[model samples]
Target chain A: MPAPLSRRHLLARGTTAGFFIVAGQWLWLTPREAEARVFDPQVLSPEQCKALSILGDALVPGAADAGIAAYIDLQLQAGDESLLIGKYLGVDTPAQTEFYRAAADNVISLAGDKNSMQTFATNMASDSLSGWAGPPASYVLFVLRADALDVTYGTPEGFERLGIPYMAQIKPDKPW
Target chain B: MVSKNCDVIIVGAGAAGLTLAARLAEGGKSVSILEAGPERKLGDLVSSQIWARKLKWSEPAVSESGNHKIGHAFNAGTGTGGSALHHYGVWLRMHEGDFSLSSDHGVGLDWPLNYEELAPYYDQVQAEIGLSGDSVKERWRPQGAPYPMPPLPLFAQSRVLAKGFAKTGRHTSPLPLAINSEPYQGRPACHYDGWCDSGCSIGALGNPLAVWLPRALAAGALLEHNARVSRVIRDANNTQRVESVEYLQDGERKTMQADRIIVAAFAVQSVRILLSSATEQHSAPGNHSDKLGRYLMTHPAGTIFGLFDEETYPHQGVTAGQLLSHDDYDEKDAAGGFGSSQWMIGHAIKPHDLLGYGTNRPDIFGAELEPWLKRASRHLGNMTVVCEDIPLPENRITLSDRLDRDGIAHAHAHHDLEPSAAARCTQRMSEGADILRAAGASEVWAGPRIGQHHMGGAVMGSNPEESVTDAFGRVHDTDNLYVAGPALFPSSGAVNPTFTITALASRQADHILSIN
Candidate 1:
């Protein structure tokens, strides 16, 4: 829960890699960028998209690279709220859609509107979110937490691609 | 009426049935096994780490209703080799103490056969099917022939967890799996790809397709799939002797007569068949003991899932599990809060392994599902705690009043953990998680209550007053009618049930031969 760097420090240390978009498809490197820069949305306002991207970037080293932003946006637009997000966070409360909705609103409040999205995220990290409680934390923390989960868990990037080998613990040898 | 007869009418071709059929055919007995499942090819049995979701009991299918469903949606095996075609083949011998746990230590009821008494039979089955394992390192493994082949290699998860056990001053070793580590009895060595739940297509996994069934077929055994046995028919005047077996074949009612019969159709359904048959025939003769559908046991599993800073291919090599701690398998210890325990099996999880996801609460479905899946691929390390489920009358299998197409009521299997059983599983599992954490995993968490191995309903014992079948698995009231499979387990040990099922089957085969 105690993150090492404060918001200003994080921004100072954070490095942004420019989108090397190829053709019209808008090739994405991080899930965070996929939300910030691209994602088809008929439901989410542009401000909502901006807030989701800002929140994702602070969760992992390169969530934007993973296209997570585009993923969540698509889910919201499609009205598929049974994301099991509540289940994963250990919350038994139903209507996770409501929870996400409240959290997103709170995140935007802390983040601010449209053009001020980046400043708002920087502000929440340093000020308003310092001792943030309940639903908003659940939302911001959960989204980043899951993105961190994805980058680490079942993907090749998490296991095989990470260059970790399954150590041969048992001595598979001739039976005596 | 003209008699419909066959050389030998065997009931249920799951593990015991298939093994006996193969042996009988080799012995020159004309045999036909009646199984109620579609014909499954090796291709059909292939599946994900969680194999049950893919396999279904085709014959006498069960319809469950209760707070705790047996989740048998695909629990029972159908097709030629029966469950063996899809079994993980985790061959383990019951300890000498396992035989008389109740009488010896004042805990659960004792099995009629002792470890020494069952030893030869376990040995026979192992040799017949070529077991691959290392009982010596197990420290607590019972006296027996050494495995024909070496133990399978433990993946990084098992290896790391073994280190944790060492650190915690507990013991962990390479699990004595039935899977082949090297070629034994003409079967090829395992590829270490960790695909045991889906039936092993390569024959390296020691499933029936790779072992006994093939030999049984070579010995001239005939397997009739889609033949759901509904009733064990006996002449009303001579109820002790079975006259024929009634079942559904090709959507038509049919019966096959034989000199003797063996019912090995798994635990729950087997009991349903007996009770359903008695609805018209004999007032449920075994019901005299009032234990027909009692003492149901499943290795109700509790699991611990953890994340590691290190990379462990939590998915590679015989995923059902590969490290074991059987020191606590003794009955007295189990009756105590210590609980019965085994180490060799933990859930083998892919990044998206369903069980693993339950451990760490995070988004599963909806938007975040994909990211969690990718993260699970690398940082996951997990283990499970397996314990014996105490039999309660409530946790039983009974024929549903509503009949199926064959006129046999669907068997309703109702199972739930007694408080003691649930607690027992929880305590042992927490101990396991502590061990994994010590192994240097970055994060550690626990999964939900799971039903993996199964048991009970038609338990065997010496007294007709207390149990349904006699020591040799013969129904106390009906001499010629027999039953096998986990259905006869008085109490499921922390150990896996397949080995005991096969050993008991061999014991019954010998008894049948003698009586005939």
Candidate 2:
């Protein structure tokens, strides 16, 4: 088997606040630290990017192999379909851009003018919920869930990462 | 000199044609099989199975407007082993009523022979080509020799669904499938990889290309590929004797004289060839009854896909589990369904297939789809509810005025569901869905109607006036011109028709051998 397609081509991008920790990763954010990720590249800010790198490392642990920051940087620069399970839903994309912008505004509205992006994260994090079978939001939940599934079920590393065991037998009489 | 010679000759290769010539010496047979299309393989099965229009067939037969569209381009096999190459291998026998439709239903015509007459043929075919199942479970199955091989094991989903049917006091039996459960004959057993429709590379599933064609070749039957038989030639003195067949090989006109002939090109294409051969000189017998391509019938089935709290592991086994629920199978007298069809459970499904597969959930994309995807990863259990469509005259196949590249007309198929038939399908689907729910599906969804299993057109029966062939699949009024395959079916029972097709094919082969 040729080696699986490079993971260098895929990663995650998250924008919000509360010192988002990408956990394990590297970044060349222009700004030194703090408030770095919040700034868009089209409106690049060196001072803000330094802080964003730290935020990037906190969102996911072991983002190093994932190359989260560089991956997002490349994707932001390109225009192909995201290939994210979210993309196939026929939702997201340009809609996500406007949605994220509005969501940011909503957080701003809820948190008030004095609240920092960091404060908004603490508030949004409280919105955690339950029941995967619920409608509407279930779709979004399904996509995010699909991402975790894509990692855990679809890839060998994801399987290993999740401690999922695979049976080698084919045409088995019963499911284990 | 008027040509009466050919480079290679092919007998019925299940539509396996030109490609077989490559294996045999090029200019071999006094005549080769006149295949209408290229032999299809795994790479070609990629199109949507739910939509017949998207499938492979001759280009000319599809039409802009017609009451009888042959669905020819999609239904029949083109290349070698013809349509035999592209079939789903769920081989079930027609109930006893399948033969006596006229006496029993008073709607469709009847066969001269009954299930008992075809029973030995079924047994022989099962032996010659392995079919796997537990026939004892089929309470409604006609008296026949038991299947040669054991049934494929059911997964967790099928077992669960069985429990549901049991709860409702309904029966679920193993479907008599053409796929191998344990290895038999010379082929290995099925890995149960669920790749049957793509043409099994391993010979477990009984495809003509993998089974009958090889035996026919071993017996010295020749095969031709890409050599499209334009028409059947007749001698002027006695038109019934098929003296030769005209074909096109690499754009060159070719002809061959054969002692015997059989049109195994499938229902629609068989009729298409007959229509095309009805040029000025041989036009009399071809369309005598206007029944050459009429009375097309296919089982219009409904599907149900359910989502549960657990991952169903749909990819773990065969496309269909061994069990089938036949409570509704023999309901020709039943007022509910237009005709009877059984319920088969827990088949494997793909993530990207157009209907029912997980890839279809892209709509519930957001947070909603995640749980279902996760749930389906392990817990999706589904079932198929097959109900027979009454033979409607309007649902027929006819020659399209448009011609093929060789100037031969393509068949146009006309297919539609009557209100009563559609309602029957709906009731069957509801019952099936109830069975699934009873079996423990948290969420369930059934289907839009699909091309029921292909049947009809050029059907065989007793009388020459109303039918294309006589019992034993011999074309009427024409000696040596036998018709085989499911095209000989007069009434299609709601079950999978492939087993019956093989039974008749074996019967025709035996008859042919006996005559020779």
Where model 2 places Cα greater than 4 Å from the true spot, the runs are A1-176, B1-12, B15-31, B39-55, B58-61, B64-75, B284-286, B359-371
Query: Best candidate per DockQ, number?
Result: 1
lDDT of 2: 0.56
In candidate 1, what are the lDDT values of residues B58-165, reduced to their tens digit?
A: 333466555445555335666666666656667777667666657764655767767888888888888767766677787888888877777777777677677888
DockQ of 2: 0.03
lDDT of each: 0.64, 0.56
Fnat for the candidates in order: 0.05, 0.00
Model 1 docking grade: incorrect
Please give me the total number of clashing residue pairs in predicted model 2: 80
How much of the true contact map at the interface does candidate 1 reproduce, as a fraction?
Answer: 0.05
lDDT tens digits by residue: candidate 2, B244-300 = 777787889977776666666666666666667774765623356777777777677
Candidate 2 docking class: incorrect
